[model samples]
Target chain A: MSIVRLLIGGATPRALALLAALLAFLVAAPAFLGPYALSVAILILYFAFVGQAWNIMMGFAGQLSLGHALYAGLGGYIAAGLFFHYGIGPWVGAFVAVAVAVLAGCIVGYLGFRFSLAGVYFALLTIAFSEFTRIAFDHWTWAGGSGGLFLKVQGGVTDILNLRGGATLFYYAILILAVGAFVLCRLLLESRLGRYWLAIREDAEAAQAVGVPVFRCKMIAIAISAALTALAGVWNAFYYNNLFPETAFAMGRSIEITLAPIIGGLGTLFGPIVGAVVLTGMGELFTDLTEHLKISGLKQIFYGLALLVIVIWRPAGVWPWLAKRLGVEERGR
Target chain B: MSGARLEIEALGKRFRGLRAVHDVSFAVPAGAIHALIGPNGAGKTTIFNMIAGVFPPDAGAVRLDGRPISGLRPDLVCAAGVGRTFQIVKPFKGLSVLENVTVGALHRHADLETARERAGAILDALELGDRRHQLAEALTLPDRKRLEVARALATEPTLLLLDEVMAGLRPTEVDRMVTFLRDLNARTGITVLLIEHVMRAVMALAAHVVVVSSGEKIAEGTPAEIARHQAVLDVYLGDAAGDAA
Candidate 1:
């Protein structure tokens, strides 16, 4: 029963219809929107996908990470490097990126779990690793180093197969990634592994007493999260056609990826999606406001204010409040 | 039904130059109710921790079914059919009662569907069926304690370790718990080892008893025999007698 429910997204009939309608609108969005609006939609979906990737680790497994850029940066470099140097397509490079990301995740997870580093300390460890990688990449000469790596963009009609397509192709790609991430997260939440993660998250000692292999479960969460995030990184690289260690691996990038889920809701399926929409929409609004007023830093201020309001008034996050208002009781809580 | 299943051989633990437990040895026979009673800070819980593999013992061994399990991790020990509850209840506060038990059941049943079915049955058996959908944080203290036991039981343990499960309960609730545990033991054929401070519940439930004081065992016998043991009386019950007088 749960299998069928999770497969269909565990929504009521009305919610199912609402979701289908929303997805259909998003799928056909490019036809109606201008280039600028389409770009914003793509940005929203990109953040949503990456945010869901981070959610698996911190939201489900209760492992807070502040340096998710490690995976994203590594993924971008691997895919771009293969395409730029070895003439490999991102189609195959994506797999390599995922593999490398999972491997890095294992190493970090092993070190952190072995040393019993957790919570803020674990978050710090992730940041330290990402920063270290960024510094190393900055000095290295291969793949353009500090100069940045750029992919060959053949100017023509949209090339959907090669990912050299226009904004429309990128938009659809991000939409697919976001929806895929949501379904994957929902399925994971109903799985046995998900139960073990919640148990460990709630109380590690009690979880161990109940026969949960805490370390293994945590490692699995980290590996899966890193792999998924790497996919998003590959997408980002292909869409932008360039990668700079400073921008790609920045601490701000990690914080930006996590902000959506934190505002939407931490442990819910649609939290990242909802959070991404709100954050991206407000960001666009603030950018427009700043442009008209000739003011800078309004975007940052808006983000800070949104985060403060969510943390204070809606600690469980906007998704749960929205659910309550909509009279929808979420399952698998 | 009669042979010893868990044997603690001179188990000892020390923390920062303080001996929390030392030279503690006892055996819980299969299908028997064994109680470990001690005064506050008497190392009863320390002994429980050692037996449950929460941490490695400084010295000596813990054996389950004549096999050493002292240094095994808590999850491995539980996998070997030894389940335990914390003195302070640790339910998954964000989870429903069924979800909490399902986590425990997942230890034995890898499939979530099977685990959920078994967890449901366990909750029903524990009289928590009506509250299956409620968040664990919403449960009252007594119900939470029952949920704790229900969780451990869902693991299908051969030997169940309960820590201070009767604390802070009303008289009627305590009685209900005693009856519940007795019925559980009779139905499940699980060996029971409990660390408890409530003497009335201990006396009514435990057939065998070990008394401890200040990190050492003071007496070991049947509950009634230890109730009258001179060392136990002087260290524990004698104080109660003096307070009453």
Candidate 2:
């Protein structure tokens, strides 16, 4: 609490100024960057948003889901399907998307937690559900089967209601999403529910003995994580103008969702954001460099090396080390 | 019978026919400090596990103030006014000492603010106020034991079952714990059922003692009575019987 207080009220003026400047930079980024660079910025914000969502389950509650891409993919498909078929806007479709994802999360969370599945078994259960959903989508011709689903492309005027726009619109759209996720994660982390999660994460038995409702808390984590990730999926289909089950619900996509928080800091508030920016920025940079050098696979090698270095140097992730270096008043939990 | 805060009714548990605990029945009258003692692997902690709802017993029942809590989940058992500390001291290692207690305090206290306030008071009572900011993993064994007690006490439990809280403490530390527990019982009238191997602390703190060996109850009486029992002496407290008496 003192740490929370210190960060909120007693932090040095320099740190406050730095934060304000960073916020200003993010808000004004599109004015200075070219269209190509802005697209990369949009990707960073997208990862930042989804990373925070994934962090809620694995970081806050310690429930590992190796199939988090299921939420994003399902959300995108449902919203895109509504827009394509019923002429409905994604704004209205998002609710249905989130509900479907939450339902999926509940089934998995209920089965995993009720049956006492922990660690790898629970991870496998999540993967199974995700794979099942991907397969179901692959054969469903109404949702485009294995071909893919695409929103109407913009040739003239950008429609904000339908989320039909240029790169700048999505840049702000995902910026809002990433910021919303950051705020929500902070709120949950400081609230009573967050304490229960940390308790369960530490030791479920000890938590239960202390009257912490382990199953309920775990389910809530999964639900919230899925709900948030589902929103990202909605934005994803609109921004990219396409949804492919192979790319969206694949195991590789889930790994991409997890990398940011794991690299930044597993359970910290700023870890996902910082990790997203670092990983996404570095990834783009690596891709650009490799393309210039005519080395196609070097980008993957860079990601592997970056993960290895972070794991070896800072096992808790980059956020804690960075926060301490900047004197950000983190309690080092 | 009405005075008894905790009652065990021929409680029995079997680990696939291993007979871990069998037909053990006892009661700690409200405001009493009771002790369950035995040698290693004698199912003393197993009995605590049963009462705390770590798992349901295969046979018989446990009642708290005329309410059956035998088959309830551990959280439900705690919500029914039972709080317990593990024999191995399972503190939430990732949390601070204050946060650890606050988790239990929140069980009864409605909100985080009040739960934190109550947890602070409990820490002060247990002489852990100074170390409340430290992570549970950073604390010494004695502090960890007190932290376990503090965490349990924060639940505002009518019954606090402590499993070997004084096992690894020094003589002075054990005496300090005994004094603190005695004052706590006097002040709060919370019924305590502790499982301890420390004869000095057990003798000092427990009003009633139940001796167990080989998963079955050998004797039950006042501290001095159990300390002088022949079966207890032969099976368990052979040398420490004199010290306890």
Measured by TM-score, the strongest candidate is 1
Clashes of 1: 0
RMSD of each: 2.1, 3.0
Error of 2 at B236 (Å): 1.6
Error of 1 at A2 (Å): 8.7
User: CA lDDT of B20 in candidate 2?
Assistant: 92
The 10 consecutive residues of candidate 2 chain A with the worst lDDT sum are A2-11
Off by over 4 Å in 1: A1-5, B1-4, B237-245
Best by lDDT: 1
Q: What is the Cα-based lDDT of residue A298 in candidate 2?
A: 95
Which residue pairs show collisions in model 2?
A: A264-A318
Q: Which candidate should be chosen as best, given DockQ against the real structure?
A: 1
Place model 1 in a CAPRI quality band: high
In the range A1-333, model 2's lDDT, one tens digit per residue, is 454552354447777787788889999999999988888788888888899999998988999999999999999999999999998998999999999999999999999999999999999999999999999999998889989997888676678898888888889989988887876787677677988999999899999998989999999999999999999999988888888889989999999999889999988877888888889888888999899999889999987898898889999899889987888756534
Cα error, candidate 1, residue A95 (Å): 1.1
DockQ of 1: 0.85
